[model samples]
Target: MPPAPQAYRPATALLDLGPTFWDPVEGANFPGTIVRYRNDRAAAEVGLADLDDAEWVRHFGRFAPLPDTLPQPLALRYHGHQFRSYNPDIGDGRGFTFAQLYDRAGRLMDLGTKGSGQTPYSRFGDGRLTLKGGVREILATEMLEALNVPTSRTLSLIETGEELVRGDEPSPTRSAVLVRLSHGHIRIGTFQRLAYEQDEDGMRALVGYVLRRLYGEESDDPIRLLDHVVRRTATLAARYMAAGFVHGVLNSDNINVTGESFDYGPWRFAPSWDPNFTAAYFDQTGLYAFGRQPEAIHWDVMQLAASLRLVAESEPLIETLQTFASHYQPAIADALLWRLGVVPRGAEPDRALVQTLERALRTTAAPLDRTFFDLFGGTVPASYDAAWDGLRAALADYRPRKPSDHPYWQGEPCAMLIDEVEAIWAPIADSDDWSRLHAKVDAIRQMGEALA
Candidate 1:
């Protein structure tokens, strides 16, 4: 049967907050290009599935504001700590929030861009993105979503006919503009900027705006907001660990207020259960390694607490900050159980199970993701091995989330390992063959549905 048409409900709540938070900006003009990809599933959620290719490129590619959306794009102002060093010079240098709208679930979503153009924050660099960068982001978000991590969605990728010079990759690389749909673009760095400026009035206004827009609460007290953000951040960190993802950069600005992980750059899934596993080639100290993500997020939370001091008491803020450790441990267990497709027994038992699994994976140097797939949704060859007896015994108390008759249980587990991702991109880099990338995305979506 054909489904009922979705209703269009575009919104612009963020723009209503006032011009103090952002600067009006224009997107760059690119040479005539074509839409490389479009997330129709996500588009349907936002009542935009009927848009033709021309409309898609006109709005997303050409950066024309959507009907009933924001009148203009906004370059949000923010500051972030880079590598533990305070940097006041950072903002949305290359991208801006193009529009805001409500999805089918009534959640306020931001239509933000990457490589859209230069803004006030574009400091001595071209506001551009490479086609390879857009491709990598698409892969990263897809894999993370399939693994049940709270993340942004890559909505569109349009290949702009421009050559960009980059030091890290092949110079004069093909250019593209990417758009990301997310819960919100407000970051921990957003508050940091307010605090740095000593703008108590601005801080108070931001606190009120965030509470009303994102949290759906009207609270004059900032402590409650801090507590909520800390809990969300801890849960996000736990999800990353369960997914074996290293974010590479744990800067305050990169951490969103909604606790939804976005702005993927140099992200990698760990091949094995190594806490010290790093993703970025430039991360010499491994400060934002796979294992240290929780710590880095906690540090970012403390910074948020510090920023809230302008409106809230430090005593309560500090107390809220202290709960992150307690929140994270149980969150890790729950996340792990979710990935394993099992109902958790309880807090203590779940923690013990997680510890047991981690110990087994580390001691045997097992492939992290493959190990989860091996034990979950039924059993693979690893289940019968004596080495996994502890995990088997632990699983005796839990039940499968999926039915035993599910077809996914009968096949090999799908994975998005580094080697596999590069292999998918290799054909495109060499011969413009995108069939592998499309196939991989389809397989990842299937995995997500099976796990669901």
Candidate 2:
């Protein structure tokens, strides 16, 4: 059955937190342009399904704050460690939190923008996003969500009729504005900034606000908060591995407090189970590679632990940090079972199964997505390939999520490889053709539904 239409319930909880956390700013005025894409599925969750192209342009492209929402947009302030070096001079330079609202599930959601406009934090640069960058983000979020990775959703993308020069891509690319729907915009860097300023009181208030809004826990203890973040971060790392995704940039600022992954810059999915695979062109040392993601996330969590020292005891925080491996290993096993679409056996047997699957993948170097499709949903094997013998034995004691006749199981696996994503955007880049992009999104949505 179709889900009931959701009603928009605007709120201003973040605004109520006061001015120290962010700076009030207005969105940039773009030349009158058209709405290029609207995520109606995501829109429905926030009661925005009926928005016309003009309305989308006004709200997203023109930076008009939603009525009855926050009175003004806020460019958040944060400090992050970029490539293991503490960079205290960073914040929301281009985008801001436009509004907040409750979704149909009663969870608080934030409507944040990217490439919205320049703010006080915009240091010596034009605040605009390339049209191609916007397109890539939409694809990244949609595909990640379909794979059941905890991620932010792309709400809207609008072309803003401006030419911007960039060093990474071709010069003078078209400009755009992107709106993202996320659980919250708070980041680990948010706390790090407070620590850097020696604002112990500010850190306490921010922690309280996060607990109330996100975790719904009544405890104000910093150790409790650290424990929660560690668990969530472990699960997030495992999910990325299970989905074969590389976030490219795992900086503290990019890691949200909610443990949901967002801000897709140079993201990619693994073509095969290569642990050293990297997505970003400029990651010279491969700091955020496929295999090192868990380590990177753990390091970021330790930074969070370090920041919390201003308000909490260091001993408790360090003890909590040590629990990461215990949380991460089990989470990875569970996520792998989820990807394989099988019910888990006993704990011992499940762990052994996970280990066997890992060893097989590493030995064969099989394409991760193809391997899932080959084994999941009760699809019969065409031959008794010796390479898959361990995997077949691993599945012997588990049941599939669907019958062998499920339609999605009958065809080739749907993969969002980087090459395919570029092909989807090539037509649009050349002649403004968006049919392929639209079709790809539809295919991804269908796969998500089938998995559910």
Give the alpha carbon lDDT tens digit for every residue of 376-444 in model 1: 752436445677788778777788877645565567777777788789878988999999999889888
Candidate 2 lDDT tens digits, 123-232:
98787888899999999999889888899999999888899999998878889899999999999999999999999999999888888888878877888889999999
Candidate 2 matches the true fold with a TM-score of 0.97
> Which lDDT values do the candidates have, in the order given?
0.88, 0.88
| Candidate 2 C-alpha error for residue 282, in Å | 1.0
lDDT of 1 at 214: 84
TM, every model: 0.97, 0.97
Q: Best by lDDT, which number?
A: 2
Q: Residue 45, candidate 2: how far off, in angstroms? A: 1.0
